[model samples]
Target: MGSSKAPSWSDQWGTGGLGSDNYEYEEGDKLKKSSSSNKMSSAKAAASAGMDKAKSAALVSADKAKSAAVVGAQKVKTGTFAGLKWFKNQYQKRSSK
Candidate 1:
């Protein structure tokens, strides 16, 4: 990786992992004191991220369960109607014979 002053491999492909432009941000002295968002502790940040991940996983599971239930209901309805139709056809043939 080249210095931020010099363009690097990241910038060549447009990924931009290279560090900041300003001197204060590079020093890490300005943003923490200035911004409210930067005040969160590392532990709190990790916990919040974990909660967010769990919430996302739960929602995805709920969506999958709902979809599965719908498919199951459709299958049951179709199967029941098909069974009834087959029974009626067999009964009709037997009566004609």
Candidate 2:
């Protein structure tokens, strides 16, 4: 009767080492990213810039509204003072007569 030889470790696993040799990769190498990732980064940057612009515009609009309110208040005060002066002048003229 002939004695059959057992298979070696390399023959049972593979010659390339881990799994298959079809995949090409190296240790410590950065992983390749798809174009979609780059596109998303660009979109995020644009959105951030847009938000900054909107915030600046809102601040400017608020400042303008505050200035307008101050000017309107000044006008009302000036008009009331002028009316009081006119009334006092008329009363003095009538008493002297």
Candidate 3:
């Protein structure tokens, strides 16, 4: 009968497991580099989203301010017209008396 030995960690990781110190170190370095890159990408995406939200808010505020200014101008024009009419009527009444 032939005897078989149990597979080691190096067999699973293709010579880059706990048994091989040099290969393990190299694999760890690669993993660290990849993780750092992923973190940087996530941060960049978040910053872009934040900037978009701020721009949208600014646009909404500007539109509201413009609308308010238009309404205010209309009110001022109506008030001035009403005041002038009242003044003319009073002046004519005083002149005729």
Candidate 4:
């Protein structure tokens, strides 16, 4: 059999074959770009869902805290009024004596 000449770099890479401003990329590169774009979209969707869940949890916690604060305020008000009434009764008894 005759000796075969090896293929040149230009022929293998398609550099000076098609035309100017026409660069050829491998199939693997195209597939990688597509797969990366899909992964990015999926990640964005997951992050958005997580943020919404966190926001709902924070709102529920805030509502519970507000209810507790209101109950505490009412108790303080009731205790203050009872103490004032006791003081007034003591003053009246002392004045009568």
Candidate number of the best lDDT: 2
TM-score of each: 0.55, 0.54, 0.59, 0.61
Model 3 per-residue lDDT tens digits across residues 12-36: 4664443443322333233111234
Give the runs in model 1 whose Cα sits over 4 Å from its true position.
1-40
Judge candidate 1 against the unseen true structure and give its global Cα lDDT, from 0 to 1: 0.66
Inter-residue clash pairs, candidate 4: none
Residue 30 lDDT in candidate 2: 21
Clash pairs detected, candidate 1: none
The lDDT of model 3 is 0.70
Q: Which ten residues in a row have the lowest lDDT in candidate 4?
A: 27-36
Clashes of each: 0, 0, 0, 0
Q: lDDT tens string, model 1, 1-97?
A: 3434543455433432324321123353222213334444665898999999999999999999999999999999999999999999999999999
Please provide, for model 2 over 7-87, each residue's C-alpha lDDT reduced to its tens digit, 9 standing for 90 to 100.
Answer: 334534565433433323345432222345666788899999999999999999999999999999999999999999999
Question: By lDDT, is 2 or 4 better?
Answer: 2
- After superposition on all C-alphas, the RMSD of every candidate to the true structure, in Å, is 7.9, 15.7, 12.4, 12.3
Candidate 3: stretches off by over 4 Å: 1-36
lDDT by residue for model 4 (21-71), tens: 233445542211123466668889999999999999999999999999999
Global lDDT scores for all candidate models? 0.66, 0.70, 0.70, 0.70
